[model samples]
Target: MDMRLLVGRNVKRIRTARGLTQEELAERSGFSQQYLSDLERGRRNPTIVSLWELAQALGATPVDLITPDDHAD
Candidate 1:
């Protein structure tokens, strides 16, 4: 499985669940809107710092964003 896609979908799901827009998440995560869009589209491979920031912005743990649901352990 592609970790990028997994992370992207998880981030998108969580962000939407929190009623946050891409721009809002970007601002909170200290990234550009375009960058956040790329991440949500699974078009960007984020660095560890970026992943941490994104997780924080979404109020999620890095593992929650990166791990596959079935393989969360």
Candidate 2:
């Protein structure tokens, strides 16, 4: 899978695991709902700052968000 898609899926998984709605994540990340949706759909190219914001909002590290799974490799 594409790296963007991988990251998006990972973000979504973490958000769900944390029991947060998209709206809540967006609010905590200081991002728009549309933007968060786009990111989750892998339709937006997230900047480093955006990634950092997402990680912070999800209580995760950037490494966790972007790490490639061994199964994928």
The estimated TM-scores of all candidates read 0.88, 0.88
Clashing pairs in 1: none
lDDT of 2 by residue, 1-73 (tens): 5767778888888999999998999889898889888887878888788788889999999888888865344
Off by over 4 Å in 2: 70-73
* Candidate 2 TM-score, C-alpha based: 0.88
Residue 45 error, candidate 2, Å = 0.9
**Pairs with steric clashes in candidate 2:** none
As for model 1, its CA RMSD to the true structure in angstroms is 2.5
Q: Candidate 1, which ten residues in sequence have the lowest lDDT sum?
A: 64-73
Q: What lDDT score goes with residue 73 in model 1?
A: 33
